[model samples]
Target: MRTPLDSPFSPGSDTVPQVWAGRTAQLSDWRDVVRPRRLAGLPERGRTILGEAGLGKSSLVRKIAADAARRGDWVTPQLRIPSGTDPLKRVAVALLDVARQAHLATSREKRIGTLLDRVEAVAAAGVSLTLREQQGPEPYSTLTELLVEIGRAAIRRGDVMVLIHIDEVQNIASEDALSQLLVALGDALTHEEDVEVPGGMLIARTLPLAVYLTGLPEFADMAGARKGATFARRFRTTTLGPLGDDDLASALQPFLVEGWEISDDREGATRVFMEPEARAAIVDLSRGEPFLFQLAGEQAWYAGTGDVITRDQVIRGWGGVRSEAAAHVERILARLPSREREFLEEMAGLEPADRTLTTIARKMGLRRGSDAGPTSQRLDSVRGIITRGKPYAFRHRAVEAYLTTYWPDPPAGDAERESTSAEGIG
Candidate 1:
């Protein structure tokens, strides 16, 4: 049922791959922490996953949601704040989604269903509410009260918990709205107070809810700038970086086995699709970036004719891979400010392995020592472009390649002559 043209590598979709590679430890840590009974004594801090665009943050979120959903101890709806959406409205809808999925008795479902209907009516009338329960046909009052109701329903069903996932969180857009969301989440984890009912009876509820958010690294900076210090401190941050060479090799192994045909000749059988040299070529082409790994493999698979993928096929595929990578790299570069683009172009002129902040400052004709630090910080804010460190290098080779290929000739001045001493990126 397998064809030579069918590629195991998928690009552009953030869904998890067949053989997930290099993230077992992170997945395990979160699974244990989010368990129903184990959530006690656990800090109610948010888990914010920070990474570059294609470094698998969304895929990791999907994997975690899959695991939690399968466990049946939690109701995890994979959600994101859609662009131009009211964050509060989207939050209410997300809660309603989880509410619909929750296992509840008939009486509880009717009550929660009525609450959802009222919340939807308020949204249709274009209004927001504070966290409080409403009487009759009025709105639910606030996100806090709606969240409390959802959590209470889940708790009454047994000790079930709710886990919410929001990706591309930077699009939430309003600081006030994001703060309100945080307050709701904070209250859910720690709130234990009695509330009065119409019949003079009182009820208290404490719901177990866990939240996770994923976005680019600059999102951290954005959160700090737009939302202030308290907003930034609400979440615990975890960063995702490119894999090492060894891990990249391990990730590629499953793809190779699944794609190729194994011959029953030697003790372990011979591979018909991948030669050792070809495998090395794919790994080298990827350069430890997950997206590039899929891109290179996909291009090479399409180039080959028969079941076997040889070194020459990989060579031919590089043309397609380079073309695709160049387009992607150019789009990323086009988003940068003019000065940041100039900084990267200058960095491209030096030997990528030896270039440092000091060398760059001198090459760019900086007059004062104080100027280099701010320039470096500015470029570092552009995620996946230039990493900030001593002897710095571009995070991806494709970025350096695009800059070297498209940059205009150096100006006829001291900077031009000094830059030519080293080889430029290709």
Candidate 2:
């Protein structure tokens, strides 16, 4: 059976291989950031990898782990959590899962039984074991105990370094929970503390273990800022941006035949893959985003029956592109409160320079004046709406399109007038 990694269209697609070609610069940056410094007998600080959704953050982390494992320097474990659970519990489960998978315990049953034993031990010590319930004051101490145990196990096996990777760090609702978790792990790795009894492990001789956090840019900011001095200062931050034109072409090369590839037909292929104007349109729309570019290409590719993609295919594929963009915008918007959503609707209607607070507030039925100062602050308060200093721009062009199509117009009570007003504003 062909793996999903083999094709872009398949479910469970593992895009890590293509990620190198598509996001070469990003991959290289991540490699430099994650390279262990322990060859010289110095412990490398843990890293926080940041990128927007679908911008290959997870792929970069996976690549780093694969590379590290291949070099035999570390044990890499990937942990994923389902939605709507305390992240600390998710982290605990992931750690236990990693231990079990490594087969350090004598038997499969023994591994889980050992984990349960530790959980009970910690709980009996007044740490909360209730995964779904609120964490008690001792949750941080409990996590600290767990990390110390894992570090001891790693040392026993002669593995001096262990990397625990947590994906989708933004999904966790409690900033304090994340903060507590990081603080506990950071203390375990850096602080000279000893765990006593069944939970206590030898401190100085234990190997170093690092926790890697991965998520969108906003989540990283939230985690870093909310975690304050302790967790924030302990880890390094790495941001992943969009692929450059050359790297973008490289990313697509594997799916294309040698001479007939899109790079060879750059201009014509772009026009075909997007509208005649869509070459620029899609680029502006995607902001050089990897997934959006691939989405646009996929739409055009599927629309074309022959070997070459054409402008007609791109035009036909616009529906698919727009649909994907709308869905993405809805997801982002769903997280916002009603007032913010109203702010977004108003902000979406503004032209590049016209998205100042005065204009947005006026449109949202807030204020009638041309003053840009207070209104700007008010608009800025709306998350994901406008970046500071820059003209109000949707994070993605697909979002702009969605806002244009779906968000109801200001209460003019006239569809024709609203259409005219929207086009005029644009």
Candidate 3:
């Protein structure tokens, strides 16, 4: 069968993977990490997966849910809230949705009747029966209560697992609320308190319930710092690194079946995708970053002749990719505070700052009298600018290339006009 690469209608090679792979393959690896057996040993706690942006954490979570459903297991309800939403409300809405799905999935009329009856009971007991409007604060407490109710209902239905998957969990308002929710979930699962789901009476129970959270790397540190909070300890933390060579190859397999091929002429393309050099050059340049790999590969594909991607094509495609990356950096820079922006601009002026936070800070004029320590501290505080450890590399290579290469002297207006006119020929 022809795959996406075989079709002329496919998006330009530079398009994001989500546009083609859908969500399945994007998250296939996560199934092993979150398998039910792996989670069985832990007390009723939470599971947290952390990674940088574009690392596919959300894709993994969705895949886990899909896999569970395929196995006839009751997948937990997933709720993705924007960063900084109230945790309680997010939890409440997620539970309500899960309850509704469970009610619908029941095959026996009596079981369906019982599910609906419970849902109605919870709604009557002050849980908002309707889904919240998009703009309002979510009713979190209500949702937590609902989860307890659903867990009980699942127990009665013969050990069905009720999962709660929350994405971008770091954005949840205040760590306290997150802590409370975790504590509550633990208690509900272990002590059988909170929603009062009648512990021993409901057949053999394995606490067939779980919570999964995804977020940036800093989330763990932030949660760790919270005093008297054990949420960090309760969770089995999984840090997702870049896709291994085998996995990366597997991800690209679907494309190879078609006429599209990675040849030896592309810059990053051949180095990473096709060449036998120690680890692909593209991977090195990308630091094995998933989104960057896709960006680089897509550019190489679009620039190649006759659909076969060559190293030269990848090199040529770098310009386009860099342009796109620059746009992203511009947006990020636009949001920075003036002082931070100036600091970043100063660092960007250095030829090669070695990607060390200390070196970049020194270049940015961040020094205290004669001491370098204060400058380092200042840089660390500006999260938007310095990004803690590594000298803030632009999130996109294209952006770095633009700032370092194109920013000095932008294309001439006349040149741009002529280029535009030439493009009109197409």
Q: What is the C-alpha RMSD of each candidate to the true structure, in Å?
A: 8.6, 9.6, 9.1
Local lDDT at 271 for model 1 = 40
Ranking of candidates on TM-score, top first: 1, 2, 3
Q: Against the hidden reference, what TM-scores do the models get?
A: 0.75, 0.64, 0.58
Model 3, range 200-275, lDDT digits (tens) per residue? 3533333556667777655666666673366645666766555554555545544444433333333423212233
Question: What ordering of candidates by lDDT runs from best to worst?
Answer: 1, 2, 3
lDDT of each: 0.62, 0.54, 0.51
The better candidate by TM-score, 1 or 3, is 1
Q: Across residues 132-220, which tens digit of lDDT does each residue of candidate 2 receive?
A: 44544356666666566666655555534567788777776665566666776677656443424355564333235656778755665
lDDT of 1 by residue, 50-75 (tens): 77667778888788777777766455
TM-score of decoy 2: 0.64
Error of 3 at 196 (Å): 18
Give Cα distance to truth, residue 332, candidate 2, Å. Answer: 2.0
lDDT of 2 at 279: 42
